[model samples]
Target: MRQRGREGLREQRPVATMEAAEGRLSSEDSGEMGGGMAAAAVEGIMERIQSDDEECRVQAAKEIRRLTKTSPKHRRQLEGTVVPLVSMLRSSNPEFTEAAMLALLNLAVKDERNKIKIVDAGAVEPLIGFLRSTNSNLQEHATAALLTLTASSINKPIVSAAGAIPLLVKILRDGNLQAKVDAVMALYNLSTLPEDINTILAAKPIPPLVNLLKICKKSSKIAEKCTALVELLLGHDEGRMALTSEEGGVLSVVEVLEEGSPLSREHAIGALLTMCESDHCRYREVILNEGVMPGLLELTVQGTPKSQSKARSLLQLLRKSSYSGSELQAETLENILTNIVAQIDGDDCVGKAKKMLADMVQVSMEQSLRHLQKRAFATPTKQSRTKRQ
Candidate 1:
């Protein structure tokens, strides 16, 4: 009986050796063991992220979120994680898909480099897809993430090129109000670049931007951003024309100047001033008779040195316009000149006023000389014709 048991043990040992040889066991080698362990860990994460099991997906997402905050290397891990996570955005279960998307949005905030990587890895399509979701929360987070990504100077042009602007603009008009606000804010930042701006403004984007300003007058954040965008739009000639167009162009601006918030007032004034500079001769009567004079005058007294300077500049613009010097009451001219002289009185802002005043004087002198030349060149009447008669 002892001999039979020994034979059985020897046969079992051979079977174990065959199994080890077939599996290619290498645990005895330290380098191979370490590499195998690392590979297995990565495979495990990939499987969990891809798993249909809700628990597996949630745990993987949570772990990735944690890793994103760990270190730069882990942030780079986001580059890999985003690909699978983006796919998960299409999941049938709203909870699982939303969990995946939030994780992706979290990864996007890690850094600019990570943002570029995510963008390069095709994050735009997924994000735009999420915009169609019925979930307002998803829209908010996705829009916020898109805003951050678009905020990067390097990524801005890329974002524009990826065809996100039109979609973003849609969100501004139709999405949840918060999403609309966020989208407009992003559009403002994105519009600073010529490539992005010219495309949207060429499509007549100013009217909508103007409407937004009217709607958000009481919201400081919205007002500030809206003012900045108005300023930028005012930088272009087409934009000025759009604002002061027959559709209450300059008319809309006048209302803002009258009733808008201080920030809105400042920007509205600045935009009007810029437009006045464009065609002051043509728009002079329109400005003065419309009650812009008092606003311009008050600005000089109550504004910052910068705003005071801007007010003075606006007056200078008005002065350049064809005022009926022959018809303008002397008192009006005197009042304007007096306000200008007062501004030049301030040590801080005087330099700017002095420069402007000198330029005006030079222009006046040139006009006067031309007038004198024309008078001197007048032809003599024919006195001989009367003698012949």
Candidate 2:
């Protein structure tokens, strides 16, 4: 399979050699490609994955991926290849680890059998370890792989057991921008678990995340990630309780929303809307006390499409909260409603506030009906019943 020419070493294969082998390999009657030239080529490629030269290793890993993708039989036979590639995860060379990761990504693509195979090979732990690496690209790709694997509902428990939250939070604060983006996505997914979300709250991830939201408001990509994290946080009861903790709770996020990055403003708006759905009375007061309407109006008039949508959404949420419009500053409410009309004319934002207005109006009418229903259902005997109780 290898020719030792004057140049040192070269791949020399006779024409039709692989074709003949391909036919044999495809035939169920024939055994796997054992003790043959195909096996030798596979070995050569695997060996090159460990080459001292970085480029050679990367090239070899790419070839291995291509080879494995070509035939089901080839992939099954090369299942053992995961061992060497996974070992590269610990290599001092980031390039080697990256190439190995790319190869592993392809390896996991063959089928469910391969996916479980790689998972069983103990790849996740080491991959999570790379979250600590200072190399931005490695962190990004490794986190992406983990995100894919951990996407399954069964994997939620596994991810929590792996201590992914603290590591992810660390990346959020210290890693480069790409790393922060990846970390945010992982956290968003992991937040599906109540226990895992508690882990994030324990790490005090919200404050730094709020800080990041402020800094990254202009970046649409980062802003979207920030919004996702907020959505996840507010989705769970534990997460909401944590956010509304006395140290500031929901109020802290409101502070960030008002003072944060424009992108963060959008994300903050969405988070607040979700939280408002089930907020305690005090939490509802926090939103009104923060004076959200005027700031939201400003954002609607001057913010980006996402920001304008977020601001408008927050206005609708505030309107829906337990804080009755009568309790709110009437002038501020008017400004916000006007800004919504102005936004419709300006068209700076891509997302719309039309649905929000309808939702708020519906919620308002529903609340009013509930109040009237309660009063109408009351009987004169209720006063006597209450006194007895």
Candidate 3:
């Protein structure tokens, strides 16, 4: 009786297996059917976008924006729609232009190939034109599109050559808050190229950028980009001059050094170091007058490795700038050390501050010696291995 019961259960297993297989087949078929529908929808949207009628094109662009906003698959399928979307940007109608620009922007997001494709389709010129639009929304969208496009390295040179820098600077001065933010990011992206630095400076970006940084939170991402660009710009004499000319520019950078994120602090210190290194006589007093000593001292102890190194170098330069000749330099260094300690901890805690600084310097020297020893030992080991080989 038990054997018979087992046989009955075995017989029922095949029916269950058939039912599960059919369910899986039905699921796969539905997925394929859904994909086919999506593909068809994309095809219809593309055709309408390419139509000669303005209304049809506008509607299509709107659909493209809607579709690409949330669907990566739609973005890829709609790649061929770029040329038409770019063409729509030339429409006299602001609504038409914005719809198309936004659609292109959405398509470009996270799609490197589409970014290049949009630019290659001649999107930069119209985008720059929109940067000058009287319509705030249009101008903001245009700035955003440029910002998105410039994020691609390949688009940087092309966008720069299309004469976007001056317009971007203008936006920094006159655009709404969001537009200005996007403009700064776009300029930073372009500034990554070595050749574009002078162009950026020629537009006198320091004042506006300095003002922007002053208003923004010190640790915000925009502040990081602002300081980074400022650091790069200071490598040029004109840039340094412009910064000094801008009221509170140097002060703003010092503030970042004291209060910004790790990378921002690195840039802030680097900009100061560049100024001092370029011409200590001209810039040293300017920097020290801003109460930079406290931040420099703090950075030496607590900042990133790069920031720490830059702080030490700048501090050394500041010390040297105090007096000429070796003997006077030695005396000046001691006086400056006393001043730094006093500044940080007041007269009462000078002794304690000095002790702490001494301990930090000692630890730094010990680490340097260890690093040098490792390199020294590594050289001989490599040489002996070469000989053995």
lDDT of predicted model 2: 0.58
Q: How do the residues 133-222 of candidate 3 rate in per-residue lDDT, one tens digit apiece? A: 899988988887888888788889999999999999999988887677778778888888999998998999998888777667677666
Which whole-number lDDT from 0 to 100 does residue 380 have in model 2? 39
- Mind giving the per-residue lDDT tens digits that candidate 1 earns over 168-284? 777766676557666766787688788777766765666665555544432245555556676778788877777655333454455455445566667767877777777776665
- Reference-based TM-score of each model: 0.61, 0.55, 0.75
lDDT of each: 0.58, 0.58, 0.73
Tens-place lDDT digits, model 2, residues 1-389: 01111121111211122122111111113233333237777778767876677788778776666555445666666677777788777778887788777667655543446656666777788888888777777886676566545545555577779888898888887876655655666677677777777788777676556545544433244555566676677776766665655343454355445555665566677677777766645455456544454456567666778777766655655656543443221433444655666656654332344444433443243444344345335673321111110
Ranked by TM-score, the better of candidates 1 and 3 is: 3
Worst 10 residues of 3 by lDDT: 1-10
Best by TM-score: 3
The alpha-carbon deviation from the true structure for residue 341 of candidate 2, after best TM-score superposition, in angstroms, is 5.3
> Which whole-number lDDT from 0 to 100 does residue 370 have in model 2?
48
Off by over 4 Å in 2: 1-59, 62-80, 92-95, 105-115, 134-141, 152-154, 235-270, 289-291, 294-389
Q: Once model 1 is optimally superposed onto the true structure by TM-score, how far is the C-alpha of residue 305 displaced, in angstroms?
A: 3.8
Q: Candidate 3: lDDT of 10?
A: 13
What stretches of model 3 exceed 4 Å from their correct place? Answer: 1-37, 323-389
